[model samples]
Target: MTFLNHRHSSFLRSITQIVTGALLFVAVVSSAKAQDEKPEWKAGSAAVVITPEEPTWMAGYASRDKPAEGKFHDLYAKALVLEDLHGTRMAMITLDLIGVPRSVRENVEQRVEQEYHLAPASLLINASHTHSGPELRSRYLLVKRHDAKWAALADQYANDLEDKLVALIGTAIEKLAPANLFYSHARAGISMNRRLPTPGGVTNSPYPDGPVDQDVPVLIVESPDKELKTVVFGYACHNTVLGLYYYCGDYAGYAQEYLEAEHPGTIAMFMMGCGGDQNPYPRSTKEWAERHGRALANATEAAIIAHRTVVHGPLKSAYDYADLEFAPPASREQLEQDKESTNIYVKLHAETLLDELATSGSINTHYSYPVQVIKLGSEILMIALAGEVVVDYSLELKRRFGNTNVWVAGYSNDVFGYVPSLRVLREGGYEGGGAMLYTSLPGPFTETVEERIYEKIDELVQEVSTR
Candidate 1:
């Protein structure tokens, strides 16, 4: 009986040993699979100088400068491509220009989709809003300056930019490898509200005090070897550093230069946040531009020096487009008889809209707007909206969705014109009605613009979260 019991006990012990070995092997295999599944973040950056030899019109701040026959500060088209281990990718190309036209963006999108396999919505192209950069597609505003020569030159520059951007993205994709992403947000008070309100007047002063976005978010990219590869920063202010005709990238461009120089081989992408109503304070000089640049660079440096939360992302991206409609302007005779005829362009646009309305009886007041949201794991939510969005959208979204991580971006897909809030529409100002002259659109947006945008954003956020 004792021998039989010992044999049974030994058999049980042997079974236990075999089970333990199997568990260990499974653990090893699971760990190996996890390692294999770990996504690698690879990145690359390239810049193409776009400064013209001869002086031309600058973009923001409205002030003009004399022809620059000699060389001035150089403008650049900087491209940063980011890809995962599986080769799915996104490219952000920042241009040191006034504004990115819808046509130009579409052209670039087609090129990226054809060449880099990047989806049209995946490519984010933004302008620095530099007043010193050449005016590309503001013919509606600067009609007299839009000569055939200028148009040809602008087309050539845009075509060249597309090629350069494609090449840059391809190079970056080829240079992909493992990398780390860390994100941090800091506030800087370098910008002020450009549209200030006057006492007891519905009309805002040409120079009015308004709200501004002070938050500056920085995304630091590090190679797998732990070397700093890029520091992408965003702020909501127009880069109107120097309103001179000589080509310059303004403060945002200078900020990139400063950061890149400070950290060699490290690229910097400056994305303009919700700065439609914001303008850089103390602008209009190379020195002030450098100062602001250093301020932004310092903010980035501080974010890096301070403890930052490393973000591991299994990125999920979604893009949605909506049609936003605007009310047609009054009849041509009525518009001609209306009060605010100080700007000839506004009157002309009104006349044009009225002509269409008279012929068709009703204008097709709808515009195709794009909204894109990207979720980085369960943490970061990056929302991109088309047109020049005001600060209220960002502030409101941040307040309503404080529980979730949100980064709202404007000047994304199609930059038709200023996307004013309901409040702005009611107030009746440049952002609401006056700014419509800047586009081919009829007039002020419908009062439902705010609600339309909010609903679309909510839908996009939900889609991204669920997916």
Candidate 2:
């Protein structure tokens, strides 16, 4: 002002005022827009223990010589129900078991649709795949599923489980009330890639340098008063800590227990991630499992304390099936030859296939796999894929669905077997095609396994996110 002309000084002052006014206007508009987009949710949750009443055959270990001797803790099937403003409801059922058979899923969905009036697409059933949990009945594990007495007991257990799951869903929906949901995550390091490449090929051992997902994604559901009600968290690691005679939920079980203890009267739900190839290291004992569980629970606490994004949701969901092709079954000559092999599992597998061919005349060449996508508010995308999914799917989906929150979950709906990525299939390890020798599946999947799934996910995301 000391040297400037009078008109020039006045012009500069006017320009500064205009720019400041514009910035203030923009900030106010942004605040209003955020308020408009925020969403309110009605949430209800219930937890029920699903452990078998009697000592029964446990799942997940082929080397077990007898039935379960004792139990470290009871297993659970927890349900969370959320209703949007439009009265549309979505229910999530998480189980502490080896896997949910396709039949169980089908029957439960049918009953829920009839009883609760919930759409098939609105319900998601996920299993923890805990190796220590009791074995459910299956038509796939033809090699060594269970003997007559145990099989009968397992069938009865599954029947009772379906009833429990249905009732829990109803209970949660009945308890629905106003709530706020937020999303946050932290990291845990107990899980490592168990498939190691050695001179002998991909061996099931801890490879510290291999790809692993240490993410512990958490969703916090709170009542109107902001009191915590339910906590849903995920980790991409197998529940195989203790392979002892006692039934347990493994590390995932212990993690849930610790969380519930820390926050009394709150339900902690654990959803297994794409952990088909991941395993908790330093495992094989109850103490090791507890250590890993503490690590996971602490990770959840860390995520709960970290900065979180408020989840405003109109709650959109989409579920569909993708037809995945399989390589042709082994020739009849190969089956006959396999029956003479020394490996008992291999022989049993061959005999089962031969019997199937005699009865059905042809083997199934494709599987109709389920894939789901849910949009939370405007930013978060949840991709729930069926199977024991590998880690590549999760990593690749996050990359493809850029600028949005992505959570890819495996072991949902129907967990047929290891759903290998194209890379794993080509690498030709147990997950590739070798494990098929123990199931009714034909063989390794066709090369389109990963592409088909990704395409279906893209389609579902597009469908759900359009609103």
Candidate 3:
């Protein structure tokens, strides 16, 4: 990868800002009483800065006309490894970037299983879906024009990222020691439903009254000496506050920064929830991103102070791919007509499918989507679904699970595109079907989308449960 000295004169200023923010964040909360004794759990965490080494094309928003101009803040890939007394272990890696491309996940997964001696199902990877992060794909056939230089930069960045992730997972596990784990949640109204229904149809705009997940779930990990080791938190919203030339992690970055600042030596890991159709309200400005970050941080702070559930060990984990089906492809003549469209994404989408039709004899009708389940004792059940997941999953999964702690994270493993619920698929909006034009996928998922996924979740839940 091309190297640039991004550590400019602003390094000192950035350090000062972090110190100030940490002090402020700490001042905002009263310290909790120390735990009497640590839980019988082993934990470790490690992080690496993944800011693009050089100017490159950024991901998200196809309207941008040029490569990234400069840096707002560096992005990162953080990992947490937890093990129980029974020797069961789980490793989770979180990144401050767009989706985890399938190629990247496949490479990292293979390396992790061979090196770490863990089952393929025990490792989980998530992306923050930050629009301000660097693009990791070598070529985006639909939305981006073919530029060899930009494509090379993206390939180099992706290769470097995979190496970091593989190393980070091992490093975290190597750093493992006795630790405590606790779970709790609070609310933050930073994200609103972006699909507004109108007389015309569901438009992609902020709809305040639509269903949204305001809950900020927090998981605290501390050493036996009562020192905070890591704080894992999640919210259901897209980290798209600033769509500019600079590189940053958006609101998720700010929340982690504030927490780490307030609690020195602590690693704050963010797991994105089902926020496919949600967006940060009053966005497109730095102030709003910071404000939302503060709001989310404050919510986590409140949860940290509230009554908590001690997550016990005997950790159980399961992972598998769900064969999600796409709708039937268009006829050859229809595809030819689509290839002639003025819209590049639409035309290219049709062209790609036409190519697949010629080569594979037909477009792919199903996707090998990733789905995971991890049970912490019999108390918490975590479901990590791939792609940009909508809120209906978090809402309905919780309801169906019947009051146990269910943390459903999106943008995990292989984030190929949007994963809409049956409702959203029926509504037929950007999240529903329109966004498919920007991907190599054949079409929107069929009507059985929600049912098929839930069935798999139930099976995995049974597979990982203790009692």
lDDT of 1 by residue, 240-276 (tens): 6676556767788878888888989887888877877
| Best-to-worst lDDT order | 3, 2, 1
What's the lDDT of the predicted structure labeled candidate 1? 0.73
lDDT of 2 at 331: 96
> Across residues 1-467, which tens digit of lDDT does each residue of candidate 2 receive?
58989998989999999998999999999988865643488999999998789888888887887888988998999999998778788999899999878888999999999998998888889899998888775443324655677877888888999999999999998989888898999999989998889987888888888788888989999886678899999999999988988988899999999999999989999999999889998989999999999999999999888998888867899999999999888899999999898998888888888888999998778899999888877757888989899998888888898687788789999987899999889877877778877667777899999999988988898899785
TM-score of each: 0.84, 0.91, 0.91
Find the 10 residues in a row with the least total lDDT in model 3: 29-38
How far residue 125's Cα lies from its native spot in candidate 2, in Å, is 0.9
Q: lDDT per residue, candidate 3, 1-467, as tens digits?
A: 22535675467679899999998877655333234444679999999999988898889988888889988778999999999998778898899999899899889989988999877788889999999988877758223565788888888899989899999999998999999899899999999999999999999899999999888888888788878899999999999999989998999999998888898899998999999999998899888888999999899889988999988877888988777898988888999999999978789888888999999897889888789998887667889999999999999998988678888899999888999999999999899978988888888899988888988898898888744
lDDT winner between 2 and 3, please give it. Answer: 3
- Candidate 3's TM-score reads 0.91
lDDT of 3 at 267: 95
